[model samples]
Target chain A: MNGLKQHYAKIIVWAILLTIPYWFTYIGGYLGLANEIVIYALAAMALNFLLGFTGVLSFGHAAFFGLGAYGTALTIKFLVPSTLVGLAVGVLTATVAGMVIGALIIKRRGVYFAMATIAFGQLFFFIANRWNSVTGGDDGVGNWHRMPINLGFTTIPLFHNSLVYYYFTLLLFALAVGAMGLLLDGPFGRSLMAIRENERRARFLGINIELHVWISFVISTAICGLAGGMLALLDNFVNPRDLRFDLSGVLVVMAVMGGMRSFWGPLLGAAIFQWLREVLSSHTPNWQTYIGIVFVLVVLFFRRGILGFKLSTVKS
Target chain B: MAQLLLFDISNGLITGAFYALMALGLSMILNLSGVINFAHGGFLTLGAYFAYVLQQKIGFFGALLIAPMITALLGLLVERVLIRPLYGRDPLYSLLLTFGLAFILVDGVRIIWGPGSPPYQVPEWLTSPLSSTYFFLTGYRVFMVVLVVTAVAALFYVLNYTKLGLRIRAGTKDLETLSTLGVNTRILRNLNFGLGIYLAGLAGALAAGFLGLSPALGTALLMPSFVAIIIGGLGSLLGTLLGGLLIGVAVGLTTVFYPAASEAVIYVMLGLVLVLRPRGLLGEEGRLH
Candidate 1:
């Protein structure tokens, strides 16, 4: 009975955490601006998989996120007008891109891996920016159709209202978090933790470290892509700026600030970041300085992140 | 054709001189502290901004004298506050920490200075071309080449002859061991980081005359600097100098032949080198952990 109560309590806490976006959307609608915080939160969650669970620190995850956004926009342009299909295509493309890049990059561990990812990401950014004919060259893609969810005979229009899109996003978020949780509880997740702790020992014990890292990279990137597609849909536009190195760097900050070890850390970090952005941008134009200061403090002092520290302390 | 090639080569050499100054500081920091220091580019940006501010208020010469000192002080503060804690941790922590600091610095500049490129004028005294019958070069560019060479030579002298340099070299080999040997490794590490950052600041100030000061220029310069360091091999000043010149020439030649390939050439070179020799051309084998 006590174990069941604990499980219910966990579910309730998650439900409350998930409901925060809905509250923000309702509040944002009344204030007359779209709620962008949710989209960022989703992106942060995707980043958490790599930074939090797996022991890889990426500075170029935004490349995948941006690729996914571009992928969805491209899919919408060429393929049939099914929002689900477009999102799927975006996720698929990002996953493949991540897998291929991961194969080459995962060979170099630690800082080299981080630098290599940044290099490849910059290469993609150049392609996206310079290849203007296809990517619309800096101006970004506009006039793309909003997400349209069709269920058999009835079509659910996703963008007619922000509330509807919020629900849709929330559903997707649930699915992603669920899938990620399942993966973390499985054997692969155990292997990832082992690799993170000691690669040589893991290898000695017969685990293929490279293959596991590559797989994590692929899945994490695909989720990031999905979040990007959703973001493009939310804003009704996509641009090369989405894939900028700064954006990738921001995801890293969010991951670190929220505490990469905790499952819900990214989500909390995203929420706090959104609130911070809104507050700071309103007061001063140079919000990045403030963010930078905070980032330095966190990295220097709060290595475990807030939630991670809290959980650890509680466990103790 | 031969004349044009010679011109390109000379221009490449001049460009390489600036890159060497920038890469040397980065290599020194990495060698001593084991952190990538993403904010190194931000220091360059800060140097340019400081030069711009000083030139407007004081005078061009005064700006040149003061900006690099200010940058070095900032580097010192960063080492003491932000980088000191990561000494015993994995390099990734410092890398991410510095990456965070880079964001803050770049954004801070953007906020204070605004997004648009700040207008800067090259002082009239330094703007003329230096001519030698057959070849003519921008006086400022030649000055840059001379200044960078002098800086590198001075750095070499200091590293080779000074007790401080010996401590830094010894610290890089093993920080704990050095500390146990009663050497003040922390102070040595801070000095190395400060010097590396100061050099970057000087490079930025000089680059402002060549490339023009802008908020986004640092981001663009960062990848090339990294490429130079990677190609030259980490933690070796001589290797970094060679790498910088090689990349500068490669880039200059590519632009001369095929302008489109110029942007991608550094990455391509990196890929080829990584595939052929993963430790980098000058990099020590098994240095990566």
Candidate 2:
């Protein structure tokens, strides 16, 4: 009877998780901002892979997200007719870029590694801003068509409505989360956790510490890229501001608020952040002050994060 | 080629003056307390903003006096409140705490001042051009260089001769030992933090006319300061001075020659330094942590 009850509870949790995006759309239909929240939530989840699992604090993950968005924008403008191909290109580009940077930076640990990543990320921002012909510079890349998935026989239009795109994003997010879950449960995932816990011990135990970190970095960047591509399609435009370090700071704040150690933390954090941003910005221009204050309070008081708190309580 | 080299060297020295001021504060704090004080940049920004506000309300001289004082008080409050609890904890906790404080301070400035750059003109008395056979320099720039040099000299003297300096040096070398020797190490740490913050504020106030006060300026200066700290060798005041000069000149010359690679120049320098001397130019071995 207990086993049956456990199975039912798991099923219910899964059901709720699956229905979240749909619920977002339902809420958006009433409130008129659900689609935006979904996109931000997706980006936040990508950040979760690096911050939550690997204990790597990135201040510039937005660079990968921006690269993905730009990749998609370029693909739509020059190469691919299908949105699917564009997204694939974006993810692939981000993954390769992530791997290259990870290889170089993973040699350093702690604050040095964090600063190095930030420098590289800012370098990308500089390129994005200065390369006017290719990137559209500060004016942003616009005039792109809504992404359509070509099935060869029938073309499924994605940008006809925000609700449809939200569902498509929901499906993609679910797939990404499921893949991450599997990856985290595997031997590689265990290795990453070990490295995070004690790098010297893990190295002594015959783990290739750098390689594990590099792989995690690539996977995290690819996820961010996927979200970036989706965001470009959703917004119908991509700007240099989308790739700025300040946005990356916001992502870090969100990841922390949601609970850096939890799988769904980034998503929950992003949703709450987005909602707060919308509500607060509507009321005052100084919403960032409030956000900063909240961040300080959280850092001061909630060392374990929101989800971490829940887990500790449950364990106790 | 000789002229270019001279220009680079001169530019570097000027830039180094600013960096030395910034890095000295950072080194002092790091030595006295194990915290990196990420809010160093924020305090610098505060100093700049205070000066700008004072200049608007009173004159440049009055603003100069008031800004640094206000900044020092803010520094004391920060040490007393946010930094006190993290003393015995992991260094990472202190780092994160300061980072939080930095975010609040930066955003707070943005909230109060808005996102735009505030106007800060050089005082009329100091705005004239000063010509020399070697180079025609701006009077304001020359004044800035002189001010920085004098301040650094005075600081060196204080650190060398004063009783407070003796306590700071002893406390930095062995805090627990000093406490056992009857020194109030906690009080020393707080005073050291306050002093470091004051220097940062003073630097900011001085930089206001040169760099102009902007919300984004703190971040732009942050990396260079970190580079200076790293290169100068952790906890070595003289080393920071040399490191700042090296980076300033290297960056200035690189920008003049290959603007495209200018941004990467500092990181490249850091990489080379790490490879050749991971302990930094003047840093003692095993002091990296």
Candidate 3:
């Protein structure tokens, strides 16, 4: 019966997601907004890969996410205008950055590790903010947008159509989520869990702690990069704020709010947060105060998240 | 040319002292309680603003003494109410909590003061140049240095000689042992947290005299202090001091050559330290990890 319930739950979630745009339109949710929610959800989930599953706190994931956006934007603007190629560049840049930064901070643990990541993240922001000619400086990297996907004989124009773009973003989200699911269920994923549970025990069991953590960090950052690329494509613009520490903090909050210990937690957190932001910002000018209060409340009270709450209650 | 160089270097040292002062507070909190105090900057902004408020009533000298005490009192309240509950949880909780508190304090200050740089008056006695040739050597600059030195020295004296200081030092090394020895670890952490905030408050007041008072002032100083803590090693106050000074000078020197890279240089220094010495210059192995 429990197995049956779990299977039904997955199907329900998929059904809702697959038709999320339609439901949004049904309930007065904007199509463009729905698309944004999907994009941010993907990013938040990528952050959770390191935080929830791996038991690591990375306050610097925005650096990679923003790198992906810039890489894709720069590639499309200066090199090829192909959407696929732009995404490839974005992923490549973010993954490479992740590997280099991972090497530097992988040895440190806890708050020290978080601090190093923030410093490096800020370093990247400084570069982007200063390089006026190439990066457009504080004006941000714009004037380039996502191109049509060429399938040799056929093409899909995802340039400006909201519905088409939402589907395309969802497609990417599905692929990334599926891949994460596979990883979390595999031996390598289990090793991350081991590290998360107890570093000493994992090290004693012959797990190369540094190597495993490096890979996890790279994978998480790479996927975050992919989400960033998708985000740039969706908005047809990329700015430095995308890579700023505040965004990173939001991602962390999203993961924790959704329940870091469980899969799908970050996605839900993203949904609620995005929705709340939309509602509150429209209603009040002190939206930041409201959002900050929410973060505090989540930390103080709702660390288990909605999904976690459900699972625990059912078990009890 | 030499005089200019001396001026810039001296300016750098002064900036470094402020960084050391700010970072030292952050380091103290981290070393003792394992909380990063993301709101350290917020506390700093408040301290500056508190001085501004008190200056209207008590004047500069009295404000300097009272404002930090108020900030310290707030710190104690926050530690007792918010932080104490999370002592047994992951360090991440405290980090995020302080992060939320940072947002609250920053926005709260903005709401109360309006988001702008408010000109603050240093005492008239401290503004005159010490030498005609070195116009940059204002009495205020010297006073700021002397005040910082005195504060840091007093801090060290307390840490070395006082019963509370010894307990904090020992607790940083081993809370479990300290607790077992019949010491109230909770009070120890609470007092230590207050002490750190007092330093942050002091740094804020000193900083306002130079940078001017603004809601954004703390935000600018916060990251460099983190870099200082990281470069000096997370667990070592002396290392934090050295790291702050080193980066300040590096940033100062960079301004002479590559103006654009001044902010970026500290990050580069951080990366180099991470690569070459992950434990930091004074960080003990396996202490923070």
For this target, which candidate reaches the highest TM-score against the unseen true structure? 3
Instruction: In candidate 1, list every pair of residues with a backbone clash.
Output: A52-A260, A292-B104
Cα lDDT tens digits for candidate 2, A219-249:
9899988888888888888988878766776
Q: Comparing to the true complex, what docking class would candidate 2 get?
A: acceptable
lDDT of each: 0.78, 0.75, 0.86
User: Model 3, stretches more than 4 Å misplaced?
Assistant: A1-6, A26-28, A309-316
lDDT-superior candidate, 2 or 3:
3
Q: Count backbone overlaps in model 2.
A: 1
Q: After superposition, how far is residue B213 of candidate 3 from its true place, in Å?
A: 1.9
* lDDT per residue (tens digit) for residues B1-289 in model 1: 7666767777777777777777888889888887887888889999989999999898887888799999999999989987887886767668777877887778878878888888877876677765664254667767888888888998988888999988888887778898998988888899999999889889888888888887766667777777787777665678888888898898789767976567678878877777777677788766655
Cα displacement (angstroms), candidate 3, residue A225, comes to 0.9
lDDT score at residue A110, model 2, on the 0-100 scale: 57
What is the per-residue lDDT of model 3 for residues B75-165, given as tens digits with 9 covering 90 to 100?
Answer: 9999999988877678887888888888888888888998887878898878988899988899988988899999999999999999999
Number of the predicted model whose DockQ against the real structure is largest: 3
Model 1 native-contact share: 0.44
Order the candidates by TM-score, highest first — what do you get? Answer: 3, 1, 2
